[model samples]
Target: MKLGDVAKLLGGRLEGDKNFEIEGVSSVENPKPKTLVFCSSKRDVERVKDIKQVALVVHTPVQDANCVVVEDVKYAMAMFLRIFYPEEHPSGVSEKAYIGEEVIIGEGVYIAPFTYIGNKVVIGNHVKIYPFSYIGDQCLIGDETVIFSGVHIYPRCVIGKRVRIHSGAVIGADGFGYYIGKEGITKLHHIGSVVIEDDVEIGANTTIDRALIDRTIIGRGTKIDNLVMIGHNCKIGENNIFVSQVGLAGSVKTGKNVVLAGQVGVADHVSIGDNVQVVAKSGVANDLEANGTYGANLPSIEWSRWKRIYLYLLKLPELFKKGS
Candidate 1:
């Protein structure tokens, strides 16, 4: 692609060398010759300052270099990446894939070998199921969805359009529910299902448990990071972002645009309001107010200092008593 063409596609302003050929897009740290590199900051610009062969998609024009200046550098970079390295939409179901009785597969669907589609599964158009994926009975997979290798979708789950579920993601898994009586501990059966709405991207190895009686809903445009565990009956709102290792206990509800950073844990039955942003490693035990940033976990320190702080905390009562 030409430099001017890239700028036109990305809706950016072309600064220099309209005819310069851009072979690909790369990072500023290790740029390839004749490729387009994104420079969001001055440091990034400085790193590739002397490299005149590569074109720059930057926030501002660099002197003596081919440049495509954009309002949002990251957005421009994403656009360039999509054009340079477009995702493959593989068509045709493999003969080795096991299609169970009465499966309704749409046109342009790609089911790789070793994939198991259970009875009465309705797969929408252009859907791609990679190798070793198990789509349970009566499941509904929408159009343009991509289920990567080793994904296990339990029976009756509904995956919406344009959803990307990465490898090892277990959808509609049984939630942790139990009852303790005089006799013994009894397991509670999860009869509900999981509904992942359109444009949601579930990261690799993330687990979304089924509800107890209804649907555990993952709203539209939500992005869940890898290694996250969402418990039963979680009604996650639209455009919510859950970072890696986030664990939400059963019945937790999050409003729209909520962001739970890495390793943030929410207790059972807690309700997080809209536009709330919880910092990394925070433990949310109660309901959070709307449009606020919250954090509870303390920052890390040296082990010796932590020990001293622990000792001081232990002696707090005595110190209070003496002061009184």
Candidate 2:
């Protein structure tokens, strides 16, 4: 692809040789000949100033190197990758893949070797189930969804169109619900299923448990990161971004555009409103209102307040000795 063509595709202005060829994409800090790099911020622009050979994706046209100026660098990167680095999948169902009786397999569906589809399963068109995946009985996989290698989908789970479940992801597993009875600990069986809507991506090794009664719903366009644990009955809204190692207790509800950073933990039954941003390692114990940035220590205080308190605490021992 040419540098000028990339600008046209991104709907951005170009300020470079239109005939310059671009072979690959890389970060702004590192440039190779014919490589395309991205400059999302002013700092990135400064970093790109020293480079001369690469094609650049920028928020504004600069005179440094060949540039494609767009409104959003990250969004443009995603779009460019879709064109240049399309995903690869095997074609057709393998003979070693097992399909149970009465299963409905759609046209162009790719079932790799060692995949097991249980009874009455309905797989949609162009769906790719990689090798060693186990799709349980009565499961419904929507069109263009990709279940990567070693993914385990328990019975009756409904995965929507364009959903991507990465390798080692386990869906519809029993929730961690138990009772201490007179005899011993009694395991409560999960009777519900998981409903993942369109365009959601579940990261590698992330486990979403089934509810005790109703459904565990992951809303449309939500992206969950690797090793995140979502408990039973959690209702996650659309376009939410959950970073790695974030844990949500059972029955937690989150509104749209919520951002939970890495290692954030939410307690049971907590309701987080729309556009709430929780910083990394924050512990949320209660319900949070909309349009706020929360972070630090216990109870998830406002981000600014948390920073102030944390700084004050660092001086506490000095103040105590001076008082003595």
TM-score of 2: 0.90
TM-score of 1: 0.96
- Candidate 2 ranges with C-alpha deviation above 4 Å: 298-324
Candidate 1 off by > 4 Å: none
Clashing pairs for model 1 are none
For 1-324, candidate 1 gives per-residue lDDT tens digits of: 788998899999999889999887777888889998889998999997456889988888888889988999998777767766789867899999999999999999999999999999999999999999999999999999999999999999999999999999999999999999997999999999999999999999999999999999999999999999999999999999999999999999999999999999999999999999999999999999999999988888999999999999999999999999
**Highest TM-score: which candidate?**
1
Query: Candidates' TM-scores?
Result: 0.96, 0.90
C-alpha lDDT of candidate 2 relative to the true structure:
0.93
